[model samples]
Target: MREVSDAMGRPWTETGRHWWVPAVRGACAILFGILAVVWPLITLLTLVVLFGAYAIVSGAMAVYGAFRGVHPRDSRTWLAVSGVLGIAAGLIAWIWPGITALALLVLIAAYAVVVGVAEIVAAFARRRAGDTEWSHLASGVLAVIFGVLLFAWPASGALALTWLIGLFAILYGASLLLLAHRMREAGRRGAAGTAAHAV
Candidate 1:
């Protein structure tokens, strides 16, 4: 672990053994974001269809897991409930493809709002923990703004969601790739360090 000083000159250990993962994910997210922004309408439609498919598949899997009783009894109950909800959602979407886009937009907007609020709350909590968390605050603010904008303009939100999704996906993928790279680097470093110690 490498120790670095914070703004307050407090030593902090950089335990980022898999830094490359995030970097790759971030890069992929960026690419996806660009695609989403470029073809918002198409992306929105595709996402709706994809969501429906995913819901059905996930619901089936959940139900299977519940029946399999892989975990505790309570876990199976939760899984069953989740499966039911997923199946219901999928059925609704499949039955009303015409309205699926609008419905998805509404759901996305609601999710954004909930996530935004949570992030803001988390940022505040982090700040109170005596850590430098300006980035978290900024991110939270952006999320809130995005959510508000989506709510304010439903039509625009639908289109924007696609771009947002793409961007997020690309970034996520890039982050994963970066983390993998970083892990490899860390492993190499550790091996070298061990070799030097042996010598």
Candidate 2:
């Protein structure tokens, strides 16, 4: 794994300045998941559009976060890469709205795997830098597992696939929400500490 920083380097928690970014992303995921689950009979075109929108939004947030923070360069790079991948996936979906179920499945799986790996990498960087929380790691693990499961069952029915994606999105969103909450709390604490020190 690439080293995020040396012993005196900034912790990943420092990136929490924009906790709302992940919060928004998480909310989007949950909303998408809910729609998928509630309307299992949704049309292929609708699903494609919804997914494409979600990916683009999620990717935009990630890219925004990457540029908005003063975090480590490596961390920003990972996020940027993930963001770009997501954007690419979304664009492909939009450009080819008539893609086959199998093709869509493959695309989704690939996006999840790549993004999950990036999250995992970022999580390790956080851990190494003295952040002690499992939310990020858990989110990454769930994403990876979801991706692998989809790949393993490429022949699943459309309805089954919808439910699977819904469940994964819900779980992933919940994890991100947890991470945002934790980061917000950490940021507050940091601010309070700084004020106390100044006083």
Query: What are the runs in model 2 whose C-alpha is more than 4 Å off?
Result: 1-14, 70-72, 157-159
Model 1 poorest 10 in a row by lDDT: 6-15
Full-model lDDT for every candidate: 0.49, 0.81
User: What tens-digit string does per-residue lDDT give for candidate 1 at 1-199?
Assistant: 2323323343222213334433432353355456566764575556666545545654565466456532223334544665566567667666777764556766645543544454456445434434343443453355456656666774754654676655544443443454345435545665666578799
Candidate 2 yields a Cα-based lDDT of: 0.81
RMSD of each: 9.9, 3.3
Off by over 4 Å in 1: 1-29, 40-43, 49-99, 154-157, 160-199
lDDT of 1 at 141: 55
Instruction: Report the lDDT tens digits of candidate 2 across residue range 82-165.
Output: 989999999999999779888899899899999899888877766666566678789889989998998899576445689999
Residue 91's lDDT in candidate 1: 71
